[model samples]
Every structure is written in C-alpha cells, then in structure tokens.
Target chain A: MEKLRLGALEAGGTKMVCAIGDENGTIYEQVSIPTTTPKETIPKMIAYFRDKGIDALGIACFGPIELDRDSEKYGYITTTPKLAWRDCDIVGQMQEALHCPVGFDTDVNGSVLGEVTFGQAQGKKCVMYLTIGTGVGGGIYSNGELHHGMLHPETGHVLITKRTADTYAGRCPYHKNCLEGLAAGPAIEERWGRKAVDLADCPEVWELEADYIAQALTGYVMTVSPEMIILGGGVMHQEQLFPLIRKKLKEYINGYIVTDELADMEHYVVPASLHDDQGIMGCLELARRALENDH
Target chain B: MEKLRLGALEAGGTKMVCAIGDENGTIYEQVSIPTTTPKETIPKMIAYFRDKGIDALGIACFGPIELDRDSEKYGYITTTPKLAWRDCDIVGQMQEALHCPVGFDTDVNGSVLGEVTFGQAQGKKCVMYLTIGTGVGGGIYSNGELHHGMLHPETGHVLITKRTADTYAGRCPYHKNCLEGLAAGPAIEERWGRKAVDLADCPEVWELEADYIAQALTGYVMTVSPEMIILGGGVMHQEQLFPLIRKKLKEYINGYIVTDELADMEHYVVPASLHDDQGIMGCLELARRALENDH
Candidate 1:
C-alpha cells in the first residue's frame, strides 16, 4: 500500500512555511521563507514542493478569502493586511504548480481542525482556538466541524471594554478598542512603549495584559460558550500570563453561570497541545480530509 | 392515526405563554400569563397545557439553564434577569404539573430553531436570530444545530463602541458599556429621555440608536459570519431602523469581507418572519422535535 502523502503551507503575515507530511502529521521535510512579494515568494514555495511526491496540498492562510459556495472565485485569497498578497489567487496558483487538489482555509480554522483531530479537543463538540500573536485570530468549532459561512470568523476584531483612566489609543487599524487592539502582542507593546518580550518580567505590563485577555475571554465565554478554549501564539510563551488570565477570567465572569468545568478553572483554559507546529499539521489534516471527501 | 399533541411555553422576563400544537407548528389552543412568581406562573402554564391534553411539553425560557448531558438538574432554569425566576426548578415543576416528558432551552435558541424549521432560515447551515427588545438577546445556529456549550451565548453583553460623547452610564448592572447597555430599548430611553416607541419619529434618536446597533452588528458580522441574520423584538417595530442599520454596517465592515449576500444591504439584514408569535411557535417546534427524537 502506498503511504498517503500531503503537502502543508502555513502562510502568516510575515512568513510562509512549506512542509511535506503524512496522515500522522509527521513532517518529513520543511522550509520557512520570509514573506515579501507574493510573486517573488510563491515561486520558491512551488519549487520546494515540486519534488516532494505529495498527493495533496493545503494552505492555512490569513483572509478574507472568496469562499462563497455560489461564487466563481471561491478559494481565492480576497483581501489581506499583507498588501503584497491582496487579491492573490492562492488556490489557483497552487493547483497550477502542483497539478493536485489544494485545500485552503484560514490559519485559525486549520489549527482548530488539527486540535480536534489529534490534540486537546479530540472528543469535544464545540471548541474555540485563539492565537494571540501580532494580532488575535480565532477559530470556532461547532458540533465537530469547523464553523464556516460566507467568510471565516474574524473574532480578533470584536469590540471589548476599555479602561476609564488608561487612555492608550489602541493599535488595530479597524476598531480602536476591539479585542485585537486591546489584547494582541502589538497592543501590549504600544500600550507600554516596549516589546511584549522585553516586558516579560515587568509586573505592571503583565497585570494589564492579563486584564485585557481576561476581558476578551469573558466576552468569548458569554458569546460562544465553548467546551474548551485553546490559547496559542507567541504571547502565550510567557507561561506566567496563563495563571493571571485564568484568575482574572474567574473574577470577570463572576458566578452568574456556574458549571463544574468552569468551577475548575485550571482544566478549562489550556495551552495548545501541538504548540507551534499546529498550523502546518492542521493544513496537512485539511488536505487529507478534503481528499477523502473528493474520492 | 392520532395527531401528535405538543405543548409549548414561551417564558420571557415579563410574560409566559402556553400553547398546544402539532408537528406542523399549528397552534390549536394557547394561553398568555404575566411572568409573576415562578411557582404561580409555572403552575398556571402547566394547568393550561394539561387542560389541552399535550403529549410533550417544551419550555423556551430566559437562561442560563443546566443543558449538560450528564447533569441531574438538566433543563432547570439556572439564572435569569427576572428576579422571581432565579434558581427556579422550571423543568421539574412543569413535568410534575403536566406528567409528560419536557423539553427546555433558551428562548432565543427556541426562536432560532423555529426560524430554521419553519421560517426564513429553513435550509441555511449557519444563522443568527437577534432580538432587540427591552434588552438585546441573540441565538446562534451553526451546522444545523443550536450552538450551546458551557452555559449559553450571552451576545447581548458583548461590548460595543461608545459612539456618543455624553456620559451615559449603561443600564446593565453587569457590564456597563456592553451592547445591551449602549443600544437596548432602556438604553435608548435613557439617552433620549423617552421610550423608544415615543422616539420612533425622532431622526436624531434613530441615528444614534442605529450607530450603536451598527457597531454591535459589525462585531457580530466579523465574529460569526452567519449566512442570514434575523432581527426581531419590540423595538424593531420602528421598521426605519433596519435600513439605517444596514447602511451603517456597510460603513463599519468596510469591505474587508466580500460576500454576495452582504453586498446587497437591503436583502441581508431582514426582519423575523414569525412576528409576535415566533417565541410560542418556536417552543412548540422544540417540543415536537424532542418527541420525535425520543422514538
């Protein structure tokens, strides 16, 4: 029996990762390249994956994508903050280069799929995955499936509570005090006038960061009520931020709606089991699932 | 062949409705009563349904309820804004009074189910039902099932942009500037010094109200990306608000997401099809579904 082979791409705002893997999410080969111009970068990705002997490919990318079921332009990356990649025909380009079926979706959705298939949310019916890096992106899983509609969920931009005395004019281009503006890594750096990693030891910065995260999580808890919430991204590396965020979430949520799961706060909010490789692994899983359905 | 008899109860903060219906969602008999003491109100509701000879009972009430699969207290009303209904044994009381298998869920969830089964969202996969009454509440349906997890979705409390410059302390005791605090009927009355019904003709009030609502819907659009959004509630009687809200949503969303459904503003944001009877009809539908699943 020939082993099922899959190619995975984790496309971020600043970088792109190309990898070849199998059904088990085991990467046999991988490469990371800086994201500059799509015209310059996509060719290198195609060159790298050309000889991988992959049967299928998946791209986990930032959106908004043209995923309308009725539209002729479905599976095209429509608009993105990454200026060089706007209106980029990612799926078409990948299909032309590889001559194989290409599966594409938002990076967060891919991560949720990866988690549900092989990570913490294995048996869960509903889960929420939040990646807090340059920006806060979220993926929701409802009834064992990725939550998809006309477009993907841009939960990072949901509006959140603002402090009265603290007047930090948030960094998000969209809505000034939205969750991404208040809790994202860039927001932390802007509010304190230093990089988040530089202030890892600073008590005041952590306190404020934890407060903003707790507020955002409070809204998520009230709005989606996921069985489990998986927190990832560069900011979570601090490790110390988790306990403070969990503490503050309990304080903010109150006991208005009590449950045994929430009563044990330590068990509810948890770090991603797959760590940094979740996006790439998720893409591979997406490809496998799509290929299975196609046959 | 005997016709299936279904009992339905629409339990709101201020009122309670009991009805008998069939699988087709046609009500044969119904009763409306003030939401006074739960003991008094629940007994009256049970008496009404019992007198009509219902085979199964569905109670769609304000939540948070115990919906967990393994919980012994499943279907009980846990917490609600209605002071008299807090910690009330709603399912137990009704089951004892009527001597029938009971189905219970949030009123908003019931409304969404009704829309999915018999109204506008009949075949849609992802739908959102938002009610803008004394307070704003919403129900989310994803992948053909009502979205529920830890407790339930409290979308009304999600924070929104504070558009006005004046100092208007929000009405909600929980989160001051949350969506309900800024845009609910009480919020409108407090800001304009008159009831929303009284200010329907005032362009200034509607514009401000539209601003707040559009801000909230912008967040909703970004977070959920529902196929169709159904709006209902007492305050929505001012039909003029819909167009104003749709225009503002386009401005706020800013074309980050491109969808044919949303591109035509007038068609995407629509009013509920069931009008005043949606809640009661939804509860009846819920009861019928539960009965069908039991077999």
Candidate 2:
C-alpha cells in the first residue's frame, strides 16, 4: 500500500502545531497557532487541515490527558496548568471535523514514537526517549508499541536522590524531590537564576544538572532496561550534558548491568536526532499507526 | 487438546523444588532437593520428573541468568554467587533429558506470572510482583506477559532517597542507597541488628522499612503504573509492613495520580495471595504458555 496523507498535531502548553504529513514522514505543510481558549484553538486547528485530505490524525498533546481508549473522556486533556484547555476534547473535535481516525498520546510518548520511527532510535527494540525541558518526562517504546498500562509513564514525578551541596529545594508542585523538580529546565533556571541556554558555559551548572539527570536515568535503566536512551527537550541542547550524563550513569549503575552497550555510553546516551520535530513527527507516526489500525 | 501435564522447577539459591502440574495450577506431586553441584542438581531434578509424563517443563531460576532467546547463552545462568551453578544451562539440560518444550525465566518474573495467573493480581492487565526478601526483586506482568527488554527489571538496584535520620550504609554492591540496600530482609536485619521477625515489636524499624519500600513503590508506580502491586518475599511477611507501606505509598505519590484506587490502599498494595506457591504456580503458567506455543 502507498503511504497515506496524515494529519499531525503537536499540542504544547503555549502553542499547537498542525501539519499535513504522510506515513513516510513527509510534512506537506505546518502552521503554528497560539493556544488561547478551546474555542479559539479548535477553529484554528480545524482551519489548518480543513481540506488536506488526511486519512488519519495524530495528536501528541501535552498531558495529563486521557489516553485510555475505553474511557468516555479519552483524548480529553485533564487537570492541566493550562486552565483554558483543561478537559478539552481535542481528539474528539478533530475526529468530528476531519472525520478521520485519530491517535492520541502524551507529547513525550509521541517523541519516543518519533525517535523509534524516524529519529535517533531507529531500529532499536526497547528504547527510552527522555525530554528535559520546562519539565522532565519520558516515553518508552518496546516491541513495536508505546507502553500504556493504568496510564502512560509519569516519569517526571518519580523521586531522586538529591545532589549534595546543591539545595535548590525543587519546584515541582507534587513532589519536592521529583526528577522534574530537581533537574528540569525550570529547576535549572530556579537554582541558577538563569535558564539552561544562558548557562551553557558554566561547568558547575552542567555537572549538577548531569548528576541529577544521570540519577533519574539510573532508576530508569535499572527498572525499564531500555536498549537506548535518547535525551531531548530544551535543556539537552547543551552538548556538554551528553558526556557528563554518560559518565555519571555508568558510575551510578556501577557494573550492575554487564553489557557492551552500557560500557559505550557514546552510542547508548545520545541527543535526539529529530530535535524540535520529534513531537510533530511522532504525531505523524501516531497518525500512521491509527490509520493502519483502522484498516 | 486437553490440559497437558507440566514439570515446574523453582530453582532458588539454597534449594530447588520440582513439581508436576497442569494448566489449571494443579500440582500432582512435588519434591524438594538441596542445591549442590550442577552435576548433582541436574540429575536429581531429572530423576524426579523422569517418569512424570510431562508435556512441557518450566524453570523459574535465580539470577543473574541469561534470558535473551537470541543470545547463544540464552539458558545459561551467568555471574552468580552460586559457584556450583554458574554458567549451567539448566534449561538445555532439562530439554535434552525430558524431550519436551522448556520455558525459562527469572524467579521474580515467575512470581508475577503466578500472581497474575492465580494470586492477588489475577484478572489484572498490568501488575507488579515485588519481593522484599533476602534480596529485593520485582517481576512485571503487563499485557499478559513478563516484562523483558534488554534485561529483566533490576528494581532492587535502582537508587532511592535515604530516609531522614536513618543512616545505615546500604549493602547492595551495585549502588549505595538502592531499594534492596534500604528495604530488603538482610538490609533490615543489618540496620536493626535483628531480623524483621524479631524487630516486629519495634515501631521505628518497620516505619523506616515502610518508608523505603514506599519510596521504591513511588518510582515503580510513577514509571510502570501497574493496576496492582503484590508484595512477596520474607520481608513482606512481617504483616505490619502492609498498612504502613500502603499509607506511605499514598503519601509518597501525594495526589500525583488522581484515582479512586490510589485512595484505597486496602486493594492497591496487597500481599501475595498464593504465598509460597507463587513461583511453582507461575512455572506451570509458563509451561502452559510454552506448550500452547508449541502448537
């Protein structure tokens, strides 16, 4: 079968990217729309691919969204800080307008699917895609599928051992010592009084950041045992973090897992190859998968 | 087409229990044999099952054992402290003698499969069987299968935050402050200068144990999001750890997951219902699956 034209939506807290793509990951056109109210946002997204002739639509939306298909509230973003879009049925509305099968998942899940399908994690079986931006989140893809149990992985909220001599007190609302609170982009800015981009040359900043990320990765690797771990999001833009995280992760693991891949961190820990496009491309993959499922 | 008689082996470090059972988890007969040299141990297990007329065999062995079906050392137990059994191809040896299909997995995986098949986690889609015993370990049953990626989940070795004011330098060789190091049976005995059974009267002991267990569960819950978490092993036998772990897990999670189930600790975190039979029962399930696959 030939590749079908698919619609992809990358829904962030601040903005939404709507694109017309295909199973081949070809983005025909993409338009960014400001996320105001659902009333404002829905119409703009509908307007983008109104007659794009899509076979399916995939929404890689910022969560906690209802991804459970059995639930009536599936595709509804719930309890988000974005009050205007809370409980909004983004997938339902898109499916209603576009009359196409829609695949709905968290942004991080989409990023992982993107990596496995077209980015850094291509050809890998079990993989972890961790994005350390304003928040820390992870997506796990294993055996040709995104893992969703009671809920998709809420990796950002898991607790971590605090780095000594570094007491930022953390900023995550739920857990004070959570990975997101301790090591995310906001945490970095909150601790250093400067954003991650601005602190690119600071050795202490990257080392502390690397230590925390490595700590989180330590838990992730031991529990999930993903073959490859792909780091993305805004904070990972610092090239220095890769090497630092690699060394620290090895030290944290301490030869617990005897494998050649763990020894060679250069290949094991890598930057996202798709970068900013991971979410949207992942949305495209979701759309493609949804279309395939429909058939 | 009827249920086939299966041979089940629960190969622990100190001893091995071999049983004959069926798909319905019925054990026709069982025998316990002391674990000595592989040469002695192999023949004893074979002698016990030789005239059993089994259709398939399953072994739930201790680690670190090679489980990857694609690896050349797939059935060989590797890098184990049990010097006599190290590099022993238990599965291969059994299959050669029995002339039947064989299923191999870690003891924890077998335990979770046991729980999912016949114990507390029965009828659940995603479940975690965690054993806090001589050593800490967990087996994940998701979508009706034991979770095995690059390797099985090494939940015990994952780093966790130290409980306040309780400073017992952890004993896990891999990581300093790991789940096993903080909460396992040996760790508890080491910290309190008495076994968990003897320390039952001491409020401080179980409180600290519960705190560490709850902390580990927080990471597991946030990451795996299993519908049910069944507690097993000797440390979990204390009985007092149950309510404390349930309450502490809720506190650790702290409304991060909004669900009625999270509120009801009575049902969420539970003791293993199959008790000592979980591993042998799980091996029957493994054998059943293996027999089914043979067709």
Candidate 3:
C-alpha cells in the first residue's frame, strides 16, 4: 500500500511556504514563493501541488481567514490588513484547481496544531502555542484539538496593561496597548528604534519585552490555563527573554493557584521545538485531520 | 419511569442555596443556608439532602475547586481567600453523606451552563456569563458546552489597563490591577468612597467602572469571541453601566473585525435573565448531565 501524500501550504504575509509531504509530515518536495499578490502567489501554490496528485491539501493561512466549513465564504481570507489579500478565496481556488480535501485555519492555529501533533505539546490534552513576530498571536489546542469558536481565538489582540516604565503607545491601530501593540516585533522596533534581531543583546529592550510578554502569558495562564505554553516566532530567538518572562510570570501569578508546574516554570512555558518546520508540519496535520473528518 | 430527582447546592462565601429539582431543572424544594465554617454549613447541606433521596447531586462552588475527577483530591476546594472554606472537600463530604453521584464546578461555570441550558443564552452556540460581584469572574460556554482546560478559566484575574482617572490599587491580592482588582465591587468601593450599590446614582463612578469593564470585555471579545455576553453579579445591577460598557466595547474593538453582532451592541451584551437562580439551576443541569454520563 502506498503512503498517503499531502499538500501543505504555510502562507504568510511576506512569503508562502509550499510543500508536498506524506502523512508523517516528511517533505518529499518543497517550494518558497515570495508574497506579491493573490494572482502571483496562489497560482504558484496551485501549480506546485496540481500535478503532485496529493490526497488532500492543508493551508495554514495568515488570517483573519474564514473557517466555517459550511459557509459560502468558508475558505475566503477576509478582512486582512494586507490590502492585496483581502477577501481572497485561497482555499476555493486551490480546491477548484487541485480537486481535493482542503483544511484551512489561521497560521497560529496551524502552528499550535503542529506542535501538539508532532512537536513540544505532543500528547498533552491542553496546550497553547504563541508566535511573537511582527505581531503576537496564539493558538489554543485543548482536549486534543485546535480550539476555535465564533472566530478563531484572536489572542494577539487581547488587551494587556502597559508597563509602568514603558510609555510607548502600542503599534496596533485597534487597541493601543494590547499584547500585540505592546510586545510584538513591530511594537518593539517602534519603542526601541531598532528591530528585535538588532536589539537581541540589549538587556533593557528584553527586560521590557519580557515584562509585556510575561504579562500576556499571565493572562493566558489565568484565562486558558493550558498545561504547556510553547513560544515561537522571530522575537523569541532572544534566549535572554525566556528567564525574564518565566520570572515575571511567577511574580504576576503570585501563588494564587499553586501548582508544581507553576513552581517549575521551565517545564511548563517552553520554546517551540519544531521551530521553522512547524508551519508546514501543522498544515500536514490539518490536512490529515480534514481527510479523517471526511470519513 | 419515575422522574429523576437531583440535589443541587450553590455554595458561595455569603450563603448556601440548596435545592432539589427534576431533570428539567424544575425546583421542587429549596433551602438557603448562611455560609459559615465547613463544620456548620456542610452538615446543614448534608441534612437537607440526606433524606431527599436524590439520585445524583451537583455542587456549584465558589472556587478554586479541583475538577480533575481522577485525582485523589479531585473534589477539594483549594486556595480560596475565604479562610474558613480553604481546602474543603465539599463534593466528597456530600457524596459520602448522600450516596449519590456528584457533579461539581465553579459557580460562574454553573451559571453559564444554566444560562445556556434554559435561560437567555439558549440557542446561542457561543456565550459568556460574567459575575461582577465582590470579585469579578466569568465562564465561557462555547460550541454548546462549558469550556474547560488545564483548570477552569480564571477570567477575573485577566489583566486590564487601569483607567487613567482611577488611582486606586486593585483589590486582588495577586496582580493588583487585574480586571477583578480594577473592576470588582471592592475595587469600585475603594476607588470611589462608596460601594457599587450606593454609587449606582453616581454617573461618574459608573463611567470609570464601565471603562474598566469595557476594557476587560474587549479582551474577552478579542480572545474568546463569544456570540453573546451575559453580564450578571452585583456591580452589573447598575443599569447605567450597560450602555457605557457597550459603547466602550465598540470603541476598543475599533472596527478591526466587522461583525453585525458588534453593530447591534445592545443585543450582544445583555443582563442575565436568570438573575440569581443560575447557580442552583446550573447545578441541576450539571447533576442531570452527570447522571447521563454515568451510563
């Protein structure tokens, strides 16, 4: 019997990572397409997978993407800040071209699903994965599935109190000091006048960054209370931010709810083990699940 | 078959509401017991239901209550601020005395479950029920089930930016300016020189209170994205606070994600139609589910 082949697309703002893989998420073929417009990018993805004869396709899309499987606009990417991609029906186009089952979800949800299925949060009943990139977003995997509701969880937009020492108005046009507005890569750049990659060694930058991240994580801890929180994305590469975030999480939690996991923060809050591959791997997992649900 | 009788106990810091009801949550008999020591209160509850011959029991407890059924201490209420009730195994005691299957959960969760089952949130797939009493807390009922994870949601502790005009340190022992600390009844009294009940007529007092609540609800909206939000508890009784919170919720959202639900704010955020009986009725629902799940 032949192993099941799956097409995975990790679509982002800057680039689209396209891959053809097996059920195990091992990439047999891969391609990277720089994001220009829907016309240029979606075709590249469709062309790559069209002849691959993959059983199904999974798309981890930069959203707010529609996920209601029954809606007429279910697969459409609606209301994105990226003007060119607004209301783009990436799923519909792909399905129309390739004629296969397509799984669609936010990039963060896919990332978390990847982590849960094959990475850090494997076998955990409750888990959270956060990406602190140009913006902060998270995916909640609870009870062995990605948690989705009215819209997908907009964890990035959750409002967080501004730090006493920091006075920069947040970069988010919506909520001025929300977690993303305060702690995301763009917000950090705006506040420190340097990109997060350049300011990796600056203690003061990480201290405040960690402060905001810690506060946001504390909110997640209190609200979602996931057993494990996996942190990833561009800014998290700064190794110095981890301990600071862990320490502040402890102080902010204040032992109101005592747990051995809280005491040993290292075991609970962790960096994503899959790193860059999480997107494609998660997409593969999404594809597999979509196929399974079809049966 | 005979109608199944279930006993429900809505235990709070102030009082205990014990009731016997049917599977439809119709109360046949009810009793109110003033909250005191475990020795005083638990027995009163035991005696009330001991002879009632209930097939199953449910406890809607003011927590943090242990919900993990497999743990040795699964039914214990751990780490409550109420000194007399700390670490009380309310579920175990009642189960031992009454010899019936017992369902247990936080009071807010019970209320939301009740609301979803038979009250205002009926037919709503995603809903949130919030109690803004001495301490603000909430329950998320998403996709027709009570949302639970590593632990129940500690929504009260979600951090919110304090209103610039309000200078009072929050009342929560942990995270001084958390939603509860900034917006709870105690916080209201401490911020202004009067309790929420007394300050009902003060437009300025409710304005700040509404500001903080709106910010918190905005966070919940961005994170949970519930279809309908049912606001209960003592502070919410101030009828003027509703429109102010709805208006601020709209402003905080900033039209980033457009929903018709957001346009009609008055219908989205509503008072708890069940008012105070949500707890015992929710417990009744819990008991009925427990009995059903047993098979």
- With candidate 2 superimposed using the best TM-score fit, by how many Å does residue B155's alpha carbon deviate from the native? 0.3
Q: Candidate 2's residue-wise lDDT over A82-104, tens digit each?
A: 89888999889989998999998
lDDT of 3: 0.85
Clashes of each: 0, 0, 0
| lDDT winner, 2 or 3 | 2
User: Could you tell me the lDDT of residue B124 within candidate 1?
Assistant: 88
Interface RMSD of each: 1.9, 1.0, 1.4
The most accurate candidate by DockQ is 2
TM-score of each: 0.88, 0.98, 0.96
By summed lDDT, the worst window of 10 consecutive residues in model 1 chain A runs over A252-261
Query: Candidate 2 chain B, which ten residues in sequence have the lowest lDDT sum?
Result: B256-265
Candidate maximizing TM-score: 2
Q: Is candidate 1 or candidate 2 better by lDDT?
A: 2
- lDDT of model 3 at residue A9? 93
| Of 2 and 3, the candidate ranking higher by TM-score | 2
lDDT of each residue in A178-233, candidate 1, tens digit only: 77888889888888888889988898777887877887787777778888888899
